[model samples]
Target: MLNRNNLKVWLKSVSLVGALWVANSALAESPEEKGLRIATERKAADKGWGDSIATTKMILRNAHGEESVREMRLKALEVNGDGDKGLTIFDRPRDVAGTAFLNHSHINEPDDQWLYLPALKRVKRIASRNKSGPFMGSEFSYEDLASFEVAKYTYKYLRDEVVNGEKCWVLESIPTDRYSGYTKQIVWIDQSHYRPQKVEFYDRKRSLLKTLTMSDYKLYLDKYWRAHTLSMVNHQTGKSTDLLTTETQFRVGLEERDFEQNALRRAR
Candidate 1:
């Protein structure tokens, strides 16, 4: 009952509808898959920043508004097939001077961390269970300082929103480590650069515990991006800590040996 022209028109419409359906199906991304993809892309973008040395100032503010400041230097070395290693050496504050902290991050596993106390002349290993504790009386826990690895958390894409006037993708990440201090974290990552703008940490009991905001981002080596200021606020305690980076040098040619435990003791 169909003429040649009519048959051709009918076939074209069916083909068009079929193509559209296929395109829509291909475009649909599950929240979990989308989250993982974003995290992977972010991690990939930050790769190959060989090594770095940074001098930072730590400002601790108590609930009463009292403040104390400490100066420190950090050295970091990128590792292959694993997370990076870092060392933090304190230089100011007579009581805490010569103190050092060493960290070896691992994906989806408990990190190896140590704190070298100059007064005791001994290095204390930070137990996985205690990683949730405060870092030098600051709002940042030991776990909070670990280098982010994609496998460390299971992520879900929450939504998209504007943060600090920049469009961002909101994600919820649950820690994979049993000893992690935070049960989950809600993160806001800039859509353009994949840089984290803010993160809200939930305690083991799933209560909102702290919020960390990173600002003043600067690009280095035409590739890497770094935040000049990081502020962590404790919701329940009304306390906060601000980390201000005074200077940073990348591609310092640091080697793996420099991050060894022995090197932690000899850190200047």
Candidate 2:
């Protein structure tokens, strides 16, 4: 017969083994669930931004290395729903003053984009198919201007690596949109903060086409994290664009009324 002390020791060992098994199982999640978790994390990072205003400077460099700079003051208002909507006004340059960019996104449909150029004094709908094209002669595509929602793509954990001196999780993302210019994307996200540090985009030919670097991240509203500088480099064209967000203010009490089509004309 087994002694009482031996029986107690055996039970304790089994309990420890069961606890470890539960922990290991929790670490292993389904692919879809992992993708959703990543999206949820990204959404949480920007949760407090009901509205915002900012000044932006866009610098464009051509393949021949020619540089052009544009400065603009922006008033942006955002609303949350099944999707999201944002309206931004551009106030700069003698000719493009009072220009406006309106964006409306739906989980089911391609994002609807409209640009009102003061010189034309008319609103032009930006075609959804043209999202892959350059934006105003800049390296950034029209799609880049849209806010990144996690639902836009599916993600897979590729590996773990070090980026910018921090441990990071390397993930591969495939855009669900059939018209997306990129065939696939590789992103490096900081492990601790879950912030995207870098992304490499592949063209339809499955070639490395462009790279995006995000830096100068700051915490807004003590909860939201924002990248102050974003740079896009086009490998094929040898062109690039630097987007510097000089100012950003959140929760400014902006309303949906500020995002209407009619409001675009009167935005400035």
Candidate 3:
């Protein structure tokens, strides 16, 4: 009988074999089909997390190495048959305190998002056309905050490459949204667990705009893997952002109403 750690290793081996089999069996599939299949598998591996809450820290850095930090509370809800809902409530930095952001993602159509400004005491709707703009002076854009929905992009398999010691499948994902600021994105998804290790965003001119790397992954429920930190670097502006999260609490009784627009203003 295998012990806890051995059991984990065995399970991972089985998952790896399954992925290999899937990939090998799809030799006759087109690049688009293969890319979509891999993406579907990636999403399936993270299903049924239900809900979660996390304490987060956002560190923003300018080209001159100047830094500022903002602390926030993040809550997320898993919506069946569609995209997820999320809310972020800022708690620190006197200037940005009491600010909140809400997101409702969808498989098809533009996502709905709103930001609440405590000083103005008003909730501002995020325009779809402006989704590419930076979020709160951070390297991450509003579009980056939206939950991943396979339908949002058209996929094509690029090639295999090793990134950070992990063999990954390189995929080309072109946004379907006409208003999207990006022309396409290149994603490196690890062969193991199908987790994304890195992604490169391309601007409308197909120029590399930024790169995001996810690391410090921790397994939850012995099944799901969540990244503890994300680093986004803007190549053109020499700006960067680091998002760090405390241990996430999964299946935290979060409801849809908890992510409503009104809730943004009420966020503490």
Q: List all candidate RMSDs to the true structure.
A: 3.6, 3.7, 10.2
Candidate 2: tens digits of C-alpha lDDT, residues 168-223? 87888888888888889898888778888899999999999999988899988777
| Candidate 1 lDDT by residue in tens digits, 138-221 | 888878887888988999999999997889999999998888888999999999999999999999889999999999999999
Better of 1 and 2 by lDDT: 1
Candidate 2: how large is its RMSD? 3.7
Can you give the lDDT of residue 239 in candidate 2?
91
Judged by whole-model lDDT over C-alpha atoms, candidate 3 comes out at 0.89
State residue 154's C-alpha deviation in candidate 2, in Å. 0.7
Best by lDDT: 1
Rank order (by TM-score, best first): 1, 3, 2
How much does candidate 1 score in TM-score?
0.89
Candidate 3 global Cα RMSD: 10.2
- TM per candidate: 0.89, 0.85, 0.86
Selected candidate, larger TM-score, 1 vs 3: 1
Off by over 4 Å in 3: 1-25
Error of 2 at 188 (Å): 1.4
Clashing pairs in 1: none
What candidate 2 gets wrong by more than 4 Å, as runs, is 1-24, 30-32
